[model samples]
Target: MIGVSGTLVRGGTSKCWLFDITDVHGRGASLEDVLLAAFGSQDHSQIDGVGGATSTTSKAAIISHSYESGVDIDYTFAQVGVGVNEVEWGSNCGNCGTAVGLYAVQSGLVRPRGEQTTVRMRNTNTGSRIDAVVDTPGGRFTPSGNATIPGVASPGVAVGLEFLDPVGSTTDALLPSGAAVDDFTLSEGAAHATLVDAGAPAALFDAEALGLTGAETVAEFGAALPSLLGLRHRAGVHMGLAAPGGPVSHAVPKFGVVGAPRDYTATDGTRIAAADYDISVRMASMHAPHPAIGLTSTVAVAAAATVQGSTVHAHAKARDGEIRLGTPAGVVSARLVLDGERLTGVRLNRSARVIARADIFVPRAERVPVALP
Candidate 1:
């Protein structure tokens, strides 16, 4: 039996399984099926896999040594849906960036240093350079921390990942289609819509168009699937995404609502004062509410919030550059580059860690088919 190992670690608000692809001989389609059978499904129980039910947990990482300059590791991200057999290799998830550095240090891929170790990562999926810094004390990899993040249960070590040239990681162009924004008139009698693809392609619509407060809670929006689906369909067309023949299936260009920052209770029951945030935004993954926030979408939202002609909040004396956000969990900052009327880039900060390191048992089916010698 071929042995393949994986490590389960928390990066920002999301978790994933990190693997060493170079060590594994057969990690292509056969191995992908094995991973699905092991962790892809939506029963909430996940039964016999490692998935944690939420989109944040249905992820995997394949790490390898890179030949690129200023980069030591190449990280490829995969998003596996629960109860589904397909694995999406679309874009990069910023939450998993922290794990890259920690994993590199633990595996002796990078020399461990005191206090902090900086590792350069080349995101294979997005072709971006992520500068990851991990906490290493006494020349040992130590990740224990007391710093609290909003969505996580307890405090853990902090690893910061900064993505350089974060725009157009997926589609090659910052706007993907060379358009600052695309407007699709809804097929159903809704209203005009604008789709933006700065960080992640997303569709923007007025909260009033859907009888939303623009200040509604996460649960409130999640419960309105039919309406959300309708919007998602319209957004898919505008963003030039493959229509799943229905609504959006792969959670691209996240759907968000922007409003003037006002005093309101968050999902955690914390009172969010208007002065705390420049603008308030909420996004979705498929039809479910994100537990706390998503790093990629956060970048997109912050970028859109600063734009002058989007459905985002219009009265905050919009900033001329990058914007900082206060979410239910804590503060998340992203950089927004505006060239003329086009959004150039939306860079985000994230962290990753290495929880476990060892070899895993690979099933026969997961191994390459053998031709008898």
Candidate 2:
């Protein structure tokens, strides 16, 4: 039997289990094997493991104090597969980055500085850097406060997540195809897409073109899943994320449909007016509709909205400063800082909490030959 130590934390809209790098590597087992066993990846319900059995909840991270200059923490975001034995390391999660910030100080990885402890994290998966400002009043670590963000019901400690130079995390180009828009041919039909690589690689389409209102609730977005998933594959190829007729990435080029905000009811049944938000967004997580926008998606959308001919820009209302995203949960605010048309970084105000420190015992890992990222 293999014993694994983990800390579960609620970061923004997702729940992630963080494992110390030492614990993960000290076992002498492949990361795929250890994570699969710990998450019970072979079970759809994840009934036998700590996994929450959903895309947002079934995530894990390996973290350590970084030796890299100017960086304080190093982490690898692992999108552990649901009902399958696989892990995707091609992307990063800003929400998890929030959790890492808090966990760093709480775990003594970094010394608290004054009131705001800045935990500079380097995502080893995508080589993206994130500055997580954790609230530690008077140089004291604290995880609970009067702060809140959309999607999650309870309030927690505030963590400011800033993605620095986040463009081209995977493709090495802001616009992976060298153009703001690309033509795609999918089983659903033909459509124009904006394949941007900011924060995380993502493909955005105008909802009207996909026969969508962009304000559909999670349940209502069900019918459009097949077509959007098909679009993801085509966009992946166009962005050079995959070769022609090759297996596409399950994470990259995160798919989203955007439209001008219209009066609609949120998932919680709260009415939101068209004037209240700048744009509407419906992003997919793995195969399901994200209850709220992912921080990475929020970053990408804000950047895409700045492009004149991009899908998001075409549909978003004219706004200044922070961009408001009308998600199923509610409106989310994301700000893009630029220096004379050159984007510097994206900023988001999120909250996170350390749920628990746990010890998971794995009897035997399922035999699955999944590759490391």
In order, candidate lDDTs are: 0.65, 0.88
- Please state the error at residue 351 of candidate 2 in Å: 0.4
Candidate 1 deviation (Cα RMSD): 4.9
- What's the lDDT for candidate 1? 0.65
Query: Which parts of model 2 are misplaced by more than 4 Å?
Result: 185-189, 366-373
RMSD of 2: 3.8
User: How much is 158 displaced in model 1, in angstroms?
Assistant: 1.9
lDDT of 2 by residue, 1-373 (tens): 6898999999899899999988889586798888987888889998878999999999999998888999999999999988998999888988888988889989999899998989999999899999999899878998788788877789988899999998877878889899988887656667888999999999998788788888998888867887578778888898898998999878887888888889989888889999999999999988788899899999999999888889889888877768999999999998888888877899999999999999989756544567999
User: Residue by residue across 1-373, what tens digits does model 1's lDDT show?
Assistant: 4456788887888888887786544654465665665573534566656777668888888898988877889988888778666777777777776766677787788887788888888888667777777767777776566555666666666676665655556555544444444444555455533455545666656555666655567677677645666667766765667645654547576676655667777767777777766665666775676655677777666655655566664534366565656554544566665667655555555555456655655444444556999
C-alpha TM-scores of all predictions: 0.83, 0.95
Tell me the spans in candidate 1 whose CA falls farther than 4 Å from its real position: 1-3, 27-29, 40-44, 137-140, 176-194, 243-249, 313-322, 326-331, 335-353, 358-373
* Cα deviation of 138, candidate 2, in Å: 2.6
